[model samples]
Target: MPDSHSLRIVHCFRAPVGGIFRHVRDLIDAQVAAGHKVGIICDASSGGDFEESMLGEMRGKLELGLERIAMQRQIGPGDAVAAIRTYKIIKKSRPDVLHGHGAKGGTYARLFGSLLRASGSRVARFYSPHGGSLHFDLATLQGRFIFCVERLMERMTDRIIFVSKFEQGVYARKVGEPRCGHALIYNGLANREFEPVTPGPDAADFLFIGEMRALKGPDIFIDALTRGSAMSGRALTAVMVGDGIDRNHLIEQAQAGQMSGNIRFLMPMKAREAFRLAKVVVIPSRAEALPYIVLEALAAGRPVIASQIGGIPEILGEASPALVKPEAESLSGGMVTAINDLEGFQQLLPGTQVLRQKFSVENMAMRLEAEYFAALGR
Candidate 1:
């Protein structure tokens, strides 16, 4: 095994946001606590002024070093430039392991890794698709192009880590069955962070916390809520917590549904804020590869009713029959069912901890650390 004392690691990713960003932060914290050298390399411009807050949060969680890479753009030539910059950084620091998250980071790492290997640089390469472009909802020509790129890139990676088994299965099929070096590492929630510490929202209060994009199915969520309200004969209050390209469209839908007073348009919130004000947390995603928001909702002792897509089945397991189809009518019926079976949903609450253990930062880091060593043929 490579000496743990001497192992240096770098986590590369696109701009920081969403679950992958949080995962990297948590992993860095765990690595630091374990006395390993860790650094974060990503475009710092995604979240505006939150860079300091994110850095502070990591520093408070564990002692570690961090580096912010310049993100010129989210795609194309800018990505190529970012790759060169990443390669230069890798060459300078010469990390024992080069791990990547997301599409931009994965492509850059694989390219740099190939160059390093050709130059006889003894550095191990690992990739975690905190749900890359391929895992995204792509029904069009653009999606096909992304799938092709993903397959082409897999040949260069040493091992690919999936945040959910469903993602791994889909990716394995896409890349071909003989593809080796794949691992399933479910994204973990901060159980302590979500434990109910305050009185939740009023009985009518429900919340949706995620990017307000079409893929997240915000419109579908609103449709379900409307249907559920009509069926249950009770007014439902909702707070949509997030922003994206589809924000205006979602707002218009909510207005059309006349859910404005009962449904508030709020800015995206941290985990604590999300849980504190929510009675029920809804993840009506059209496609998801194991969402952290749902896991966090469960950890907070709230009922989560999400679609049966991507890695969600793994999270709900066999006990909770909560997965609904992605369409509005189907999800509407599911929400109604969830509301009618409050007792059953409550029973499912305890089971959240079962999958909760699977997502611990310590476990994820340990597994990754093991992978890094194994990549060196240790």
Candidate 2:
């Protein structure tokens, strides 16, 4: 029923939020523009009103249509029912490629895609970890179990896509060398995103945006802000954007630390809009797999101070002065330096031209499309 040149692609993921959601949206936009029929299958219970609004905007553009079903974050008895429901949806979509993002989605895509293959259907299965279970430590019992499952899943996957070399290395170390094909494709930004965003006159001294979780290091940001203020001998103003399970705890921590008056907490908003509220962006994440926020900040001509973990070093250059350990002491020092010498610190970041050339959405989509066809043997 479809043209020979066009492919039917279905994306599967659990939470339709954060980087995985952004990645899928970009891919669907490019695929639709290229005349491919695309659809999505993700958890219905995960995202909030903001995510609902985003999904509503994307509904009409999908030819195969969007399918949302209740999917759990943790492994449980309910997964069997969820998997059956998801498999039925995949069957109805009749996708040529079942591309999964994150751990849960990867399991469903590969498992269901292989099931479809067993039934005499030709479908390629692809998975992107997106720093999901890969963040687990090998020293932990849970990590061993997760890595064992990852090893078993390789047989069902046609290709494994890593967002960074750091992620790939982690996979190799944890799950052993992949038995299937794999590729490293960095996350990208659109041309419109490259335009600089000027800070407002009332912009705060620093900004922390992203999920307020321990893994993301919202507490670290608060601690650093407190210390930075003390070191400068003046109350440093800051804005913390985004909501998560740890948000209330972070707020309480700030209050207990006597920083309640200086920090403003707000709900999650667009990255560019949030960028204008601050003179400098701080990403003190304890772990990451090449965050899009870092790319977006640099594209908007904003100075950034980020933890030297995951693929951040790869993005900021190994020798970048902005790179710091994910510690309150180190980040506080970096924050002070940036606040004292804003102009010089801004110049230390990667230029817009360099970021544009390396992380373009067009290139990311083109390469991914090529890989899809290659996997299909076309």
Candidate 3:
């Protein structure tokens, strides 16, 4: 076997944060631990949000270096220059494998990679959508156009990696199969620091982490909770974590629903802290490709009430038969049942330990290393 020092990898992504960033960060950390040389290329647009901190922590902890491309939210001439800068970085880095994450990274890496591969370079390109534009159902004309573009660009990909089988299936069913070298890798959780803290006496009864976006279902989640009689009055309290453009509207909804006293809108939380304090973790996301919150919640021995969407089912498996649809009534029922069956759910804690083992970053690293070798036909 080649020493880790002999293995070289370049991971590319947009501005930091979210599952994709976490996934790449874990990969870089593990690779470094195993003695592999890892490099990250991204934009330098951190307002120090959760994503920024995750990437920043990697820079601090890992000896690996980063290349930051000047970028912004909107596309313009600057983006083209950023892409060129990325190409230059990849050329100079000369890694054995190039990993592209999310939409911007995947598109740029795929296009530049096609150029490199056409020139008979030894580098192989792998793309992970990380819940990008590719997975969403864009049935409209614009959506169709984007899908076509993705299919065209996919031809340049050496391997298409999906964070969840549900995501992989969505792409494969629409774009094609795994014959083009597809692998389903679940997002890994930092399970080590996720041990349960003593439950807080004054902690919110339910915690909804993640951004306050519609797809994340902040409004829907609040609505569902309101519908449930169990959640009525100040008997049950909730904390809404993370902020977004929709925070005001979500707050408005919470107020209008007469849940103001019962629901507290909290700023984003550190992962371990959130998991520690949460009694019943709510993942009210309308769509998900295996959320880390669900994994983290279960690892902390907290019962999770999540929508039956995407890879969530894959993670929860058959443990919670009350897995509800992403609707007000259904999700409300899930929340109530989770609370009612907390002990039964707690009985499943042993299984969560087992599941945690499977989704740990270390195991993900080993699996990914194997996948990379297989992709290279080593």
Candidate 4:
């Protein structure tokens, strides 16, 4: 194995947005700073100028380089072509560690890692689910199929990294305990992120700045915003800053509900920038594996209101007022309370000092680097 400090790592993932992208970015930044060779291979179909800007920032940081191509979010005929293309790319990079984030990325990384090994290449294969297909109920056919695939893929995985304990436990229960190696590592942020983001002069009352999808609960956020405003007898202003499969639909719904005056839709930007534009940040995701938005918002000293699903409780405290059920009505209550008494919710947030100790990019990268070396039997 190469020296732990000089390993070649390639990260594979689908979308270059949301928490998964943020998680990879934090790790890549830390790893690159540590003088390790790192690269990224993700989908190029969705992101616009926003993702291009993110890639531009990382150009010099990734010594192993970046390759964005045709990658799909679902399993289909296109996957075979994509996989062949991905295998050829991985072969050229000659990565010491092929670490995959999300489902499709996991499949490609592991399968290609095995194929490389068969051709006498030594590469440590790692997979982080990143709240992928695991959200499916085990009772359904799709859930059962996904779980079966997970079991088969375990054979090719050198180290399975679960970003949160909730994800680890869910994988264990749904797919049965993994027969191979695994570790639970929380998503973390850089030290600078823990510093407060002073709200701008024209900050909105609230911000919902994640992917525009039903699963992430953009619809629920609008509903909660409408309800919260009605409950508090105020026409609160908010911003929805992201684009996705449901962005236009969500915007139309908000407009139809007569919220055009109160709600504004915008494109995705840096989380820090989003923080500065809002008094409070809200993550209404229906499912997650410890979202970075929650950590970013809290670290920036902005009050957060998040759903009580997946590993959110681990960050927001098990009994935190910010943690609410994944329903419009439940979210509305939190919003109403927060909108009516922002200072009260502000005081309940966990301290930045506490977060600094628990979630640091340095710690996360060190642990993951150690895992990579271990996978290579170094």
List the pairs of residues colliding in candidate 1: 188-359
Tell me each candidate's TM-score. Answer: 0.88, 0.98, 0.89, 0.97
lDDT tens digits, residue span 76-158, model 3:
77887888788888887777788888878888777877777777887778888876765556677766776777788867888
- Model 3 quality (TM-score): 0.89
Clashes of each: 1, 0, 1, 0
Give lDDT per model, in order: 0.73, 0.94, 0.75, 0.89
True-structure lDDT of candidate 3 = 0.75
- Candidate 2 lDDT over 1-378, as tens digits, reads 358869999999999888899999999999999999999999988777878999999999999999999899899998988999999999999999999999999999999999999999999999999999999999999999999999999999999999999999999999999999999988889999999999999999999999878999999999999999999999999999988889999999999999999999998888999999999999999999989999999999999999999999888999999999999999999999999999999998899988888898998999898889999999
- lDDT (Cα, 0-100) at 295 in candidate 1: 74
Highest lDDT scorer: 2
| Per-residue lDDT value at 119 in model 4 | 92
Candidate 2 — which pairs collide?
none
In model 2, how large is the Cα lDDT of residue 12?
98
Candidate with the larger TM-score of 2 and 3: 2
Clashing pairs in 3: 17-51
Q: List the candidates ranked by TM-score, beginning with the highest.
A: 2, 4, 3, 1
Off by over 4 Å in 4: 1-4
> Candidate 1 residues 7-37, lDDT tens each?
7778888767777877887777667667677
Model 1 C-alpha lDDT versus the unseen true structure? 0.73
